[model samples]
Target: MIVTADLAMSLDGYIAGTGVSPDNPGGDGAEPLFEWIHNLASWRERQGMTGGEENRDSELMREWFDATGAVVMGRMMFDTGEEFWGDNPPFRTPVFVLTHRPRPTLVKEGGTTYTFVTDGIHSALEQAKAVAGGRNVDIAGGASTVRQYLAAGLVDEMQLHVVPALLGDGLRLFDGPGLGPRRLEPVRVVDTPLAAHLTYRFAT
Candidate 1:
């Protein structure tokens, strides 16, 4: 079972802009950061909605969704995306949220079930993998969570949808205590007008 992570980041390495609030979830530059996948037919289909342009971007999004069986994310993502995701979230799988505060199991309208993990990062990953069975467990992040997983060397595969934007100061995907040095083997690369999809596997 591969532990995977996927993110749409800016050219400056920021996953999200600063001043993230209830109103501006990804902050001021949030829209531009994730606009690539927002218009995909796969995104609309995941939301149980219809009518969206189908293309390579949409196909990529669909592949990611299909590949993932479980998800792990930070508390910030849950808080900020709760309202935006509405009653049904796009991830139609079990989600393990890393948080300080413990909450009751939130069962949504779709197959998605939010499980809060207060123990530790490894604990969350373990739970997610168990639920995922033999399928891949995705680390759906908000920077901090991704960093923790990466630093621990738990991620087997990663895909970054690099958008053409520069948010100098914000939450970065690699922000954390020094991860030292690491290497990645390029798996695939796809270029588009809005973003470039880069897939990599942790070097063995």
Candidate 2:
């Protein structure tokens, strides 16, 4: 199974902003960053809603959602966005969360189950992969998590949704020690008014 890190970032290269809170998970000035996907028809359907326009963006959203089997995420993404996800997160799959604190597995109303891993990144990835079976293991993020996986060269594919906005100061996507010079081969590029969807595979 291949590991993938998928995320949406601002044109300035920030996955999130500073001073993240329960009120502001993506942090300050980050709301516009996700307006693209959040407004898609597929997004609304995932939320159990109706009445949205269909377009290439929404079609791509459906493809992304259908390809994931399991997810690995950081604690910050869980704490900040868990409640906002309601009882059923859009993931609809097993999610292994890397955290310092250990917690019991949380099963939501839908197929989504969150397991907190206190051991390490490898442990979380192992658990996620095992549950994922032959399907892809997705590295769901909050910048730090994606950076960890990318730095380790564990990600097989990376799909980035580049929003048109710019965050002057916030949590950047590539900010980490020993995380650059990793080569990638562009696989696909889809352009929309809201964002540019870029897909890359790790160069073998």
Candidate 3:
């Protein structure tokens, strides 16, 4: 399965701007820093569909949607707060959500469930792989979880959405005690209305 991490970044290399505190903000104040995503398309038609013309960087975006089968996300992602499709999210396959503590499996209408896995990203990856059915397993996350897979070299591809802004500091996309140099092998680059999409293959 494919392992990919998608994120919007500021020009100064900040993901959530300086105010996205994990404390009182719980990363709320930084919400306006950068945001994204779009509407659904008829899978049967095979006709490409995105939120708007903004995703002129359709090359990688389309590739992501087409390749993704199973999604392994971090805790923040399972909050069911990304209600793009109302009470139900669009992802139909099993989504393995990585968390530190246990939680109940939250099943939604569009076939996506918030299955919390307290075991770690690797365990989540294993579960995602099983249900992946030979398709790509996407690492949908909030930095730390992506870093977990990155440190282990579990992620195969990464699409960096570089937005034109600067927060100077905040949560870094990749950081920690054990992390070292993980070189990026550039695959392709394109422009989107809100940002520039850069595709890089991790050197394993």
- lDDT of model 2 at position 73: 95
Query: Cα deviation in Å at residue 23, candidate 3?
Result: 12
Q: For every model shown, what is its TM-score relative to the native structure?
A: 0.96, 0.96, 0.79
Residues 96-117, model 2: lDDT tens digits: 9999988899999779999999
Question: What are the lDDT figures for the candidates, one per model?
Answer: 0.90, 0.89, 0.68
**Candidate 3: misplaced stretches above 4 Å?**
18-51, 58-60, 80-86
- Look at candidate 3 and give me any clashing residue pairs: 2-136, 2-137
Worst 10 residues of 3 by lDDT: 39-48
Candidate 3 per-residue lDDT, tens place, 1-204, comes to 677887777777666644433342325334434344332233212323334432354445556666777898777655533443345565666888877778788777656776888877778888888887888888877777777888788888888888777666677786676668778899888875667778899886
- Return the top candidate by lDDT: 1
Which of candidates 1 and 2 is the stronger one according to lDDT? 1
Name the candidate, 2 or 3, with the larger TM-score value.
2
Clashing pairs in 2: none
Give lDDT for model 2.
0.89
